[model samples]
Each structure stands twice: as C-alpha cells, then as structure tokens.
Target: MKRRPRRTIPATLTALVLLAACVLVAIVAIQLAIGRTPIISYRSVTGTLHSIHWNDTAPLIAGGTCALLGLLLLLAALLPGRPTVLPLTGDMDAGVTRRSLRHALQNTAATVDGVTRAKLKLGRRTIVARIRTDRTNTAGLTDAVRGALDQRLDQVAPLNRPAMKIQLRATRNAP
Candidate 1:
C-alpha cells in the first residue's frame, strides 16, 4: 500500500483559520452581554427583516482570503515529496534513510588526512562530498575520499552504486 504524506502544514493552517473564524463569531456574540444589537445585522438598507446587511469591503476581503487559502491547500496536495529512506540491495526489503547515509559518508570523508569537516549530498544517481581540509594538496584528499566512500558503498551495498564527486576546499586558518 502507498503511504500518504503527512499534511502537517495544511492541517496547522486549517486549524489557525478555524480559530480565527471562531474568534470573530465570539466577538459578534458578545453583543448579547451588553444588551445591544450585533454589528452583523439581518436587516438590509431597505429595512426588510428577510435580507442581510454586510459591509461591502468585508465580503470581498473575506472571499479573497478564502480563495488564497484554497489555492495554498491545492498546491500542498499536488506537490510531490522526497521519500525519507532509500532501499538497499538484497532479497529482503532493507533500506537506509538519507540522513543516515549522509552522516556515514560525512564521517567517512572526515577520516581523510588534513580533512577538518565534510558534507555529503546523496542522490539516486550521484553522491557528492564537499570537504574542507588543512592541506594545499587537494589531489590526495580527493583520492582518499573516493576510495573511502567506495569501500563504504561496498559494505552498504545499496540498490544503486551512485557515482561519487569530490569537492575539496582549503580552510583559511589551517596550519
């Protein structure tokens, strides 16, 4: 069965709008406490009891707000989301989350000599690592990162062996 993406944002927005509507209703209802007629009247300018009266600008503003909300909800429903986990190779349905894979790759890259920090971006077809190192010779760092990542990939054995790209950066204050 396919899983539905959580409607966190939309749900929150809906709750907030409903709360605002309730507040407006309460404000109108409060006229009872003071024994005064409500600001929103049922009698029109012609004084007919069956007709309703409303400020002209208020309805337009409320309609526009509702329209904007509907548009946002539609966009949220239609947009595709990135999955959290990527399936790995094997007869079993094993998988690793992107966060875990990125963490592992970053740690692996950081083990290279002179490397102070590492960041990794994992995709279906590519694994890119950006490394910051103390050494001016980035050629060696690139080779080391590639080899380490290859060994890590072999161990994990993901469904696809994505091509690795290394970006080496020199730290300004490195000794």
Candidate 2:
C-alpha cells in the first residue's frame, strides 16, 4: 500500500491568508478604538459594497474568481501525492526509502565476484541492474549478480518485488 502525503503547502497558504486577514481586521479595529483614521477607509468600502448590486458585472466577475480559487485550493488539499517509500513485509510496520533500496540492490550486485561496478534502477514492473565487469568472459556473471540481488531482496522482503533484469558491459584487458 502507498502512503499519503501531508497537505503542507495548501495548509500553510490557507493559514497565511487567514492570518493576514485577521491581522488587517485587528489593526483596523485598534485604529478605530483610538479614533485614528484607518489605513483602509471603512466609509469608502461600505459605499462600494452598497453600490455593487448582485447583477453588477464587477461583482459577478469577483465572485466567480473567488469561487474558482476556492475550488482549486480544495482540490489541491484533497489530491494525493506520490509515495516516497516502498513498503516492506514484516511482522511490524516497516518501509524502506526508494534511494536506500536501490543502493542496497546495487551494493549487493557489486559484491559479486568479477563485478567492478554496479548501477540499479527500481521501477514498478522491473528492477534493472547494469554492471561493469573486469572479466572478459561474462558467461555466468548475470546469474551470479541475479542470485546475489535475490538473496539481498529476500532479506529485505518488500511487498512489491519487481522482476529483475541485468545488463553487462565487460572491459577487455589492455596490453
């Protein structure tokens, strides 16, 4: 099962907008209590609201814009994000990061005999291991790498284990 991401971005933006509105209201109220002219003129705003009828184009446009913005924010908050970690199978709840799991697989393949370097890509359907070997004849190197990786995977025991693929590149010995 995939993990759900936290709605940090949407939540933070909404909180900041609400905070700014609250601060503006509080500042206006404080100015009014001290009998000072507010930074925003209340009389002008009241007159503008009174003048804007329901059928006015300006009001309709402003209301439509606000509704669209609200819907966008709601969708952003509700949508799910990509899972960062792959789930591991165990008695307890456990998971491994994608980077770490890929690194572990590469390291396992590299530990095999005659393998000089190893790079691995883990995807939804396949885990591809690209290895560079010093040995000229790579007859059984593929199986060896596959066996080593399978053993390591058995230890890790992930819920979704993909099929493995090996690509070999051998460097001929220089005289």
Candidate 3:
C-alpha cells in the first residue's frame, strides 16, 4: 500500500490553538479557586506599614491574554497568505516540480483573451488554475483558457483537465 503524504502545518496550528485555550481556561479556573484577590504584604521603609500586593488576577489575565495571542499567531501563520490561487497538496520533495508545472499552467492560461494574470496550483493528482480577467469578458476568457490548457498541456497527466476558476477584476492599464 502506498503511504499518504503528510502536511503538518494545519494540524499543528489547530493543536496549538486548542492547547492555548485549555491553558487559558486552567489559569482562569485557578485564579477563581484562589478567591481572585490580591495578597498584600506589609514592610517598613521607616518603621511604617508600606504594603506590596501580589495580584493573582493580574497574572491570570496576563497569562490568558498571552496564550490567546499565541494561538491567534499560530492560526494566522497556518493560513494561506492570499486568495490569488488554488490549493495544492503533495510531498515536500515535489515543490520545484509542482512550481514549474504551476508556472507552465499559468502561462498557458494567461495567453487567453482578457486574462490579466493566472495562478496555478498543482497537486499530487489534480491541478487548479485561477485566472484574473476583465469583467466584461470573464466567461469567454475562462472558456478560452480551459480550451488552451487542455490542448497545450494535455501531456501532463495530472493536469490534463484541470479545474479552472476565473475571477473578474477591473482591467489594468498597461504601462
């Protein structure tokens, strides 16, 4: 049986978030159990009752905030950087190969009419292309892109009939 590839970022982030939430809850519970009050101690600078208070609530709040922030950061790191392209899955060693295939697919898609840019994602068994096109002719441009990719890159087995997403944006003036 073939072994499946593993990508841990998503799982790790989820675990981190869960763990942080648990820790925050535990801290809050502990503070509550301790009566949620500051302990004050008195010392003398010049034979006076100058007091110092150890605030258990402050520590609990601070710990909870830090844990929550850490969880948020982990989640943010795990999220995809932008929504410009499709999502892909593959082994670590296939990065370059996948990137090259993606570039080729993008190039092919960009050749279609009204397409301003193309972003491609190549997975282990499938490929997806996202095309940015002018709003006026997006459907036509998408159809043309699909046709062109099907004709030009059919030799690439995994990507022969890739799924295509066309996003219509304002046409930019060429400089």
Candidate 4:
C-alpha cells in the first residue's frame, strides 16, 4: 500500500493540539459522569435547561482566530518539501541527489585558484557557490569559479541550467 507523505511540522503540531483538546474534553465528560463539577467555573446549562448566548465580540474574535489558524496550517501543509534530487541528464533516472550535487559543486569550486574551501547551495534556479579564499582579488576569483562551474556543468548538460552565483569569503591565511 502506498503511504501518505509525512505531515509538515505545523500540521503535526495542529494535530497534537486537536488531540490534547479531545483528551481535555473527555476528562471533563468523565468528571461530569461521576457527579463532580470540573475544576473550572461553568454553569451546567444543559442540565438546567437554560439557553446559552455567545456575545458578538468574543465569539467573533475566537472564530476569526480559529479561521486564521486553519488557514496557516493549510498553507504549511501545502508548501513543498525540500528538493532531494537534481536532474543532470535527459534520461529519467539520470540524476544526482542534493548531497551529491553539493559535494560535486564544492569539488568543482575548489579547483578555482586561491579557493581554500567551498560551500554550495543548489537552489531551484541558482547554484550559489560560497568560497573561502586567501586571494584579495574577489572579482577575478568569482569569474574563475563561474568559468569552472560552466565547464563542469557543460560536461553533464543538465536539463535546466541554473545560473551560478559565486560569493567569496576572504580568509586570513592560505591553506
């Protein structure tokens, strides 16, 4: 059987809140069954056959709060999860996992002159390469990284060519 995707954090929290509320209600019902009043102050309207009326302002505020919470939770649940793979070739199965892509990009960036360390973030339409370098000529380093990335990417020729962005972090000492 196909299992549903895991709930997002907000959805999980909402579900937990609902469960806790049901448990609280059950506790109150049990207390009433045993002929004991709940610890909280409340008139037994049903038992006394009294009509209950909700004041406009309080009810409206409460209803609006509930509506907003529901909408927020729905939005959270609908948002897409983090992408795990990047397609590198036209073949359906030819792809690299996000981790592999990061490693590969880092390795490629490390090939650039004066780059001591490289970190890469692969976004939907951009490959952001953050590099630590000892060289002060950041503009030249950026262009070099971009050229290396272009060559590396051309080797695979991914279906979508996400633009490369190079960010340099100058290091005090050369590695």
Candidate 5:
C-alpha cells in the first residue's frame, strides 16, 4: 500500500498525553470506589462543575483555548512534512536521502575537468552548484560539469529530475 509518513514526535506526544489522562482518571475512579480521598477531590470537581456557567468568562476562555488547540493539532496532522528521502525510479521500495544525493552530485561536479572545489545546494526543484577553479580561462567548464552531472544523474535515476544550475568562480579574477 502507498502510505505517507506521519510526524512521529507529535503523534507520540499526543498519545502519551492521552494515556496519562486515562491512567489518572482510572486511579481517581478506583480511589472513589474504595472510599479513599482522590488526588483531586471529587467534591471539588463537582462543586466546580456546578459553579460553571455557559456564559461565564472562564468557560469562554476555556472553550477558546480548546478550540485553538484543536485547530493546531488539525493543522499538524494535515500538513505534509519535509521529505528526507526522494524515491527512486524503479519498482523496488528504494529511495535516496537528500544528504546522500547532494554528496553524490557534489562529487560528480568536482570530478569534472577544471573544477577545483564543488559545493551544491540541492533544492526541491533544482540542484545549484558553486564550483571554484584556479584556471584563468573557464571557457567550456560549465557545460562539461553539466554534462557530467547529467550522466551521473542518469545513473542515480531519481524519480524527479531537478534542473541543474552551475555557477563557476575562478580563485582569482583574470583581470
């Protein structure tokens, strides 16, 4: 089945909070049944409930707080998280992490002729490379890097091919 990943921390936290609340309620119920004083007195809780009114400022504030919390949780559940791994082209359930892909692309760029050092910023839609060369004339270096990157990308075979952007910089200006 095709399944999207969930945000683990938030879901885990929510579950833990609910579990704690249920445990507390169970403990309170047991105390009441055994004729012992509950941690939070049942009389106080009943008194508070009796005193609460729909039109009271306290109820309004409590309702507003609950609504806001519900809205926040809804947004968290609905919004997609940042993708750490990009899927491969084949049928296998295999994928490459962004860090590894960036490393591979940087290596490809660095191996190209006239490229001294290569730094890559791999975005969602593009791979931007900043290459440094000590050579005075960098005539066809950009194209060479691009071609090499394309070849490497073909081998990698990611599902979504990002556009390549090459920025060549000489160690020192020819002028």
Candidate 6:
C-alpha cells in the first residue's frame, strides 16, 4: 500500500527570523527609550547615549537585519513540502529505531511452528507483534512467540513485554 507523506518544520529560516526580530526590537527600543536619534550615513547609523558618541551603528543594523532574516527563515520553514513515506532527518530518530526493532520482532514471530506470516511494530518502549497461523490451538504458539521474542529482544534492546501486542489470525492450512 502507498503510504502518505509527512510534513515537518523548517528550522534554519525560523531561527534566523526570530533572532533578528528579538535583537532589532531590543536595540531600537533601547535607543528610542534613551531619547537618542541615530544619524544615518551610507548603510550605517550612529547615536550617542550618556554623553558618549558611538560612531558605529553597523552592529545594531546588522543585528536587526539578522533578526529580520531569521524571521523570514522561520516563515519559510512553515511552508508545506511534499509528503514522503520516509521521515526527514529531523527529530524522528527514536521512531525509526523503534520501527527497526519492531521489524525484528515480526521476524521472530514468523519463526513459530504454525505461523504463516508476522508483522511487528514498536512504540515508545513497547513491541507489538501480529501473527498469522494455521494451527487450531494458538495458545501454545502465542506463548512461544512471546516468550522467545521477549527473551531475545531483551538481551539485545530491552523492551517491555507487558506492552507487547500479539494478534493471531487463524488459517485453513492447519495440520
């Protein structure tokens, strides 16, 4: 089945815009509050505070510009991108790792005597396994898969067994 794509936040641009807005607002507000009018000269501004003439407005301007850029970047990140089945390289490491572990669990489930197929999924600290089997009595197979997988995975990744999910599907090929 085709899976829907996922959307995520854009970080870089968002940071730039937020940083620019904060610093610029601070500088402008501080200068205005102190009753100082800056003199603009060729991409620079100069102002005086406390009887001291600061000749460089470049820092303030640069900071403000960076804030604006940061804001714009933040906005750009909010834009939606095409959906994808695979997660982007952002904050999905834990989820991906869980998926890998779940796949492993499913493989283990399929190794049972009567099991025909198995699917597994991992969430947070739990592993869920679904098994399709052809046996009339599934209790034994269920217990076996659970015990075996729990022991095996615990030795490797240490997952919670109580949270494990097992779904058994009975098939017609029972011996």
CA lDDT of each candidate? 0.79, 0.89, 0.59, 0.76, 0.89, 0.61
TM-score of each model, in listed order: 0.69, 0.64, 0.37, 0.72, 0.68, 0.43
On TM-score, the leading prediction is 4
Error of 1 at 174 (Å): 12
* lDDT of predicted model 3: 0.59
Better of 3 and 6 by TM-score: 6
Q: Which ten residues in a row are the worst by lDDT in model 1?
A: 44-53
lDDT tens digits, residue span 17-50, model 6: 7898788767777776787763323124323333
Model 6 Cα shift for residue 35 (angstroms): 40
Instruction: Kindly report which residue stretches of model 6 are placed more than 4 angstroms away from their true locations once superposed.
Output: 1-96, 159-162, 173-175
Which digits, one per residue and each the tens of the lDDT, describe model 4 over residues 28-141?
888888989885435664643345346556667888999999898787678766556566666456666667767777899998778999989888789999989877556688
Over 4 Å off, model 4: 1-7, 41-55, 79-82, 137-139, 154-157, 169-175
Across 55-77, the per-residue lDDT of candidate 2 in tens digits comes to 99998999999999899888987
* For model 6, the run of ten residues with the poorest summed lDDT: 82-91
Error of 5 at 5 (Å): 2.5
Each model's RMSD to truth, in Å? 5.0, 4.7, 12.0, 4.7, 3.7, 14.8
Between prediction 1 and prediction 6, the one with superior lDDT is: 1
Which digits, one per residue and each the tens of the lDDT, describe model 1 over residues 1-175? 1134577989897899899989877876787567788766634424652353455666678889989989989888788656567778889887887789889988988987778999999875798899888776566778888999999988888776789899888876435
Where model 5 places Cα greater than 4 Å from the true spot, the runs are 1-3, 83-85, 90-95, 110-121, 130-147, 165-175
Residue 160 of model 2, lDDT score = 87
**Residue 9: error of model 2 in Å?**
0.6
Model 2 residue 30 distance off true place after TM-score fit, in angstroms: 0.5
In candidate 1, position 19 carries an lDDT of 100
Candidate 5, pairs of clashing residues: none
